[model samples]
Target: MNKKVTILNDKHQRPPEFSAGSCTVTVYSLQPWWRVDLLAQYQISSVVITNRVDCCSQRIDGAEIRIGNSLENDGNNNPRCAVIKYTSDSSSYNFSCNMIGRYVNVIIPQNGTTLTLCEVEVYGVLGAISLQTDVALGKIATQSSSSYPMFLAPFAIDGNRDSNVYAMSCSYTDYYFKPWWRVDLLIEYQISSVVITNRGDCCPTRIDGAEIRIGNSLENNGNNNPRCAVITDIPAGSSSTFSCDMIGRYVNVVIPKNGAILTLCEVEIYGVPAVTKKINLRVKFHTSEDMIDSTTRHNVFQQFQMVSALKLYWTQEPELEHENKGFSDPSPVHYIQR
Candidate 1:
């Protein structure tokens, strides 16, 4: 911009340092980043960036665009949506970031990098539709193995998101093969997503490689269920939601590794209740199976019962036209369709 840029259009050619027509400039630093807080969560769809058009537009290359509800590591630790690998051909670049977050961060990952942005625009829908209620709250939870009483299984589903294990101790398991934590939803649910809060006091990396699984099968202690997502990394004390989109009565967080301990500060499950389908008719005559399902209370065995014993009265006389004109007709076959 003009060296003498000032406020509004009253440029001495001196634009104000923090307003429109002015650019954000950072001094010599390592991996510099610029971020904007939207103050509320949003399901971001895209981001449009206006690089310094006056000069040095090439400096925006290799910069990563991140989005998430985290301030850890200056918000650079959030999930990356896109990287500006080569934007030399244009000063205005748009990136598709279909992410949900309250903050948008643009950072240069290398050492000794400077970030400059004239404008950054983020687009998304309000979070009212993106956020949902927690289904795992106050539900029964269990772990593969445990040695500590304070950090036992139930702590993860207590509706607490405190990341500090020292403050609000999280659920944890003993160092065992394929350590896992499971929550029984009691009823099957069509889970849409799961948010897990990692321990912030220490060992946040221990949560990595954990898989979120959802299913009714308890094979391998529920660890064998279909996976929703694998834990890569969530910033310290940050809760990240993994889209499950699976139907199950149980949700498991398992680390498919030997001699590893699993810890979770909080586990928030969100989804709608699964629609119940009519069970198949349990046609049985002399089988030993229960006559009624213990859970569904639906008849599980065929029972022979007589239909209504109705008296039949018929008149085939054409002289009684008024009485027989609006009469009902009934036909009975020797066999039933159902």
Candidate 2:
């Protein structure tokens, strides 16, 4: 059916300007079986004509592409066509037509439509390099010397750079002794620098300090715990080697042999510097009878009130000597002491 469609700028029937050369015309059909196909027959160098669907269909079974043509199975043998003829430049170009149906309508840019150019680029790599290190403070033997190593993983992006290393330790026990600990970190290496921080409840009262020993001689000793200590400014990816000696009294308090099970209370790392950060350390120690004695004191005090109540006098005591004399011996004093 041949129908005349009025293209208006508003619902009030206002006619808009229709550009002459390379103008885009969009055709929409209300019929359920209507199919449309767009093709660019002629190409223009400076201008391009494109068509797109605008509105969508409300029908549940209907679907459409808003910017393209419809690819529906219609009995009509003649295929619908949207032809674009370029009147300006003379360059043949490729055109693409998307499908639209009851779900969508079409919209086209007018001849004088201004278009801007856009560009995009992407970049990526196959692999990346990373570095990591882990430090673990080991247990120090009582009245004996023990050492633990801090693991270091030296990695490189292109090449390996040998770097210097340093070790650090934090005291987690509360024992009456120097709040800080020092180990002969380096045996023969020179310390470029050292930093320490009093972590945990080790400050305000105790002066936090450390002694750096190289081989048999002490390198440095101070009361200030450095936050960032560096033996040497090594390469970009290197490590340092050092140890710390935690100086504290052994938590070995002997208990009486007859004492009960003793719970070793928390050991306090005393003498911490005032500037130390609060840190909690876990220390495992053998229990002693002193702990048992303290617990016993608590238990005895808890039953003290009940025991005191039982001691109140409720009855008079009998005089055993007078009662043994029998009724005849006492004479007039026959009645035993009441």
Candidate 3:
């Protein structure tokens, strides 16, 4: 038997002898392909392929490189980046594939063509960070209605998308009615995006026409909030992400009609919390000697501008407090920070 699986194990050394030791057999089949799982999604920049340095280096020509998140057809049906033409002896070929995916596949469609990959190097950055902010997990979840038993309102925010168990994986609302679900972020945030998971077992079309709304208002059951996006289609047991770069305290998903059912497996929010900054200042004068003359008053005003934290605007002449035996108090100066 030939050890055909040795080519994918990170051993790119030139074969000392051609005996199926570090190379795959050149077989005649339309389904000859090799796949690499990146474990997570990434904004890929390029892919590097190292060809076998020994004999049969020409077999890698015409091979296609594909990248995508789908596992359909072993990822061979994904989008193609480039096709390899030829490589010199003991050399590698580089292909720029600026796409986002978790799987990379190498395929050859012609018969009698063997797909051999000595080594494959992928370079990319974390795609999720750029698309969304920090994860809004462990927040409060509620809904307009529930179906009782196990399909409660809290399942949508529990962070589980598996529809196999039904009750635990998804939350089902009563009948085909105008149902709604919402999450409370406790405080206002600059929302970046929202991800929703659809039921996988059956009736995936129940979530069609659902509208996502975000705002700081709870009037009309949070349905009156600003509309973000409307759901058109989502694959069964899959999640779809939508961008909502707005400021809000609530995220609501509601079906406007009364005949449509609502089933959501999971809901995730990403945003940044809002914060306020407070500043305090105090000024004191000891005696009238502090401002004995007009020159001393000018020096005091100039010193105020030197303080980088304060921005002074010379409006009108200061109102001198002549009644005080201590330093004369000037009219309050109005200023703002830069």
Candidate 4:
């Protein structure tokens, strides 16, 4: 009977409002080239969500999160999803999901807290893409010196000839083993034909069977000789001119059966010329194994310049210097008379 006057007020305190202060959603594409058709796949490792709330008084029993293109519960059925169980003391929670879209959104909710959203982040892995162009050797011209063989006419070859010869044989003991700078030739009689042969012991193998083109045509043997060539029927005792498309150390020429006198003109050949134009060489990182380490890369660059400096010096006779000095020395003066 005493309980009739007792009344208790039960106030239902609204559930503690919980909210995520800041959240970050990052996406990364592992492929080299981004292709939508490939259905982009990614590893979402650091999917962290931060919440600003008091964990001591109210405890968070559970958390619900959704990430995808659409915001629905099923959310476009994105192939990726992230869920987290957080406590009041938890500072940040991380989850991972894989999806194939250019955009993604993350929604987070706590049992006793208001829903929070993080800024959307999009990421994708693309495949390596590159393009390469062929190195081009521009038009090359052959020039003949004024002292060209009077019997040889300056003939141009378009590189069609089989045994085409633009120069005659000449030997320099000093340059026998070393590369030649240039060649000069003089002919006294009319040159009937020209043929080039590899005569020097150190002739570059790359020169063998190489075609010499003039303008745009090939220099070919009109008679189908084993060597590529061009023939001219100049009259006897007359001078003709000829030139070489490329500078080389030595070239052998075949005189006609009547054998006319041919002189070695000036030769302009030497080691590979230094590149004056800009050149770009790029290296890409494909994998840990394929990556070129710093040490190895530096060594390669150093070796290139070292080899370029090592020029080939031909052997020479000691007597040649004595003779040259004798000819070049000026007359000795003992005393002057007034």
Candidate 5:
């Protein structure tokens, strides 16, 4: 069978080169900084920065390495992974981040400071599952705006938390005012918790400050729903569960601010659906002789005894042992998406 999947990736791209003149760059400016976008999200392990070799290596002292998804403050507002107290001549310094993000930034907080770098290397592992009673599985989902067709909303409910958008397992929205994401549970439930997996390959910080709302109202695209919880943070390549005891058919994750891009690797809802526990089906079948007749419409219910109704309750039988193949997607499109 033909299938397609986005797998984990490694550092192979050439490091970005600034080619600074040891002391010429970032001169006489407040919060002088530089940042690079990796185009997609990943779990950043560490960042390697090479200082200018020609001269003035001291200019690189006190530079901070910040890694996160947000571009606020020229990406300098991102979480500080490490800070450089000092740098020696023309060498490289490696700072461990262990965060998931798309942007890597170097910032000098001091005014009238100079920042220079010869090269910036970001090392990370890309794209990487659990069975779930997740009510949101295979449910209809949508977002404010998709960055691309490949990062549509439904992917968040596809039952995969690969955390890599390239894996086609994460949902992404474009930069917009108060960007939001929602899932239609189809029925109201007393929700207990929400499990969110941030983008592992990059930009995991984008999920912060988002509000989890649950209600039946579609006002403001379900964003005006009753508040369940406000997310503070979730590390990259990590799954954080928020306890939300609320009643609603729709669940929304909205970043209540402008210039925001919402992303979700996976959203699983858990609760008792607003329906009866037991299920029953009753039916009447036509006589075989009448069924064989092509033209006549049979009314077997009036002429014959009705069959007993079948009753069933929620339960599961032992599942057959199956191979654990790495699979994550909805419709596994074999053709490459253009």
Candidate 6:
């Protein structure tokens, strides 16, 4: 248990203390994490984090908010809401999660840092197809290797950041060549974008040259999926948002088969559920008989009148026959497959 002296030191616990001087102080460790369970799943709209009002308010900087269901790694592997880079005198930070989840974790990653929270307020409602909902909720997260125990593959999606020096704050692959991390959405989606958080404490460059791919192919850990983005460079403890705009069920981040460490604080996938659209067909018939003499035409007109009265028909064109038949009306009416 990373130490939280402030939360323990506070004399009043009825309403959370707003001052860092009066509330909780985390131990100086890598990836100090704090979590709250909503008890039931919800489509979260936003999270409001209150920082210490007194000195060391900056301790809250670079912190991240993760929301999701999986208690794997104690909810540290949930999808991220956002990262805090700066704070004002108000010390109140709001991040739009727009996702569904049962647990919310706030963590600081890397080393030589402490996480202090005066209070954390979560605002959300029952689940719905909310635009703010993170599609990565309860999705399966995996990695190429499990070199470190605490920084295993699950931490990346646990929605927590490893801000302190402890090795437990981030995900790590073996020293093996070509390390990778992948998440299965269970179903296909039109991924609009992906947001990735990198370790801030140290070795931020370890993630450079990582390829983000999206597709259903499991070959090479979905590395063969369409390329979404390649991480050229990203700062420690900060996140980069990439536009994928691709369709797939798996999202992968892999480093080419080169020996390099792959660490991720968090990965967020956002998009709408994939749906199949049916092709609409317009059928027309032709005959040699005159419009008035045609029995089929009379029947069609009657049917159209009834259907149209019920407002089931969308369009009507009496001259459509001429358009299909062409000039002089072809006698041996042929159905044009237009």
Top candidate on lDDT is 1
Q: Is candidate 3 or candidate 6 better by TM-score?
A: 3
Every model's Cα RMSD, please? 13.7, 34.2, 15.8, 35.0, 17.5, 12.9
- lDDT string for model 6 (1-338, tens) is 11111223334332334433455667898789888777777766566666775567777777778888899988988866667765464666655555678888988866778888776767777654456335775788888888557877666766554443265656778776888889999988888888777777778788889999999889877888889999997656666768788888999999985788788887778898776443333545554445544575556556645644222222332333446444222133212111
Model 1 clashing residue pairs (backbone): 4-13, 4-14, 5-13, 5-14, 5-15, 6-14, 6-15, 6-16
Model 3: ten consecutive residues of lowest lDDT? 1-10
- Clashing residue pairs in candidate 5 are 41-201, 41-202, 42-200, 42-201, 42-202, 43-200, 43-201, 101-202, 101-203, 102-203
**Candidate 2 wrong stretches, greater than 4 Å:** 1-169, 177-180, 184-187, 200-205, 208-338
| Residue 208 Cα positional deviation in candidate 2, in Å, after optimal superposition | 4.5
lDDT of 6 at 312: 26
User: Which whole-number lDDT from 0 to 100 does residue 300 have in model 6?
Assistant: 55
- Reference-based TM-score, model 4: 0.20
Instruction: Write candidate 5's Cα lDDT for 1-338 as tens digits.
Output: 11111111123322223442222255668878887787777666567676665567677776777777898777887866655645353377665444567788888878887777666777776531112257888788988987598899999888665666798878889899999999999877878778777776678688889999999889889998889888897766555667787888999999999898888888878777654344322323223333323243233222322332322221221122233542211111122111
By TM-score, who's the top model here?
1
Query: Which parts of model 1 are misplaced by more than 4 Å?
Result: 1-124, 127-131, 279-338
Model 2: per-residue lDDT, tens digit, 1-338? 21112121223221212332222332442322222222321111011222221211112011111222233334222211122222223222112211112221222223322221110011111111212111111212121111323211111110111111232222222332322233322212222222222221113112212232222322222223322222222112111223333322121211112312211111111121112223222222222223235464344334433554222221222121234323212111111111
For the record, the alpha-carbon RMSD of candidate 5 to the native fold, in angstroms, is 17.5
Off by over 4 Å in 4: 1-45, 54-61, 70-80, 108-113, 117-338
Taking the candidates one at a time, how many backbone clashes does each contain?
8, 51, 2, 58, 10, 34
Our tally of clashes for model 1 stands at 8
Clashes of 3: 2
TM-score of 2: 0.16
Better of 3 and 4 by lDDT: 3
Model 6 stretches with alpha carbons more than 4 Å out: 1-129, 162-169, 278-338
Q: Between candidates 5 and 6, name the one with more favorable TM-score.
A: 6
**Cα lDDT of all candidates, in order?**
0.70, 0.22, 0.69, 0.26, 0.68, 0.69
User: In candidate 3, which residue pairs get closer than 3 Å at backbone N, Cα or C atoms, i.e. clash?
Assistant: 287-327, 288-327
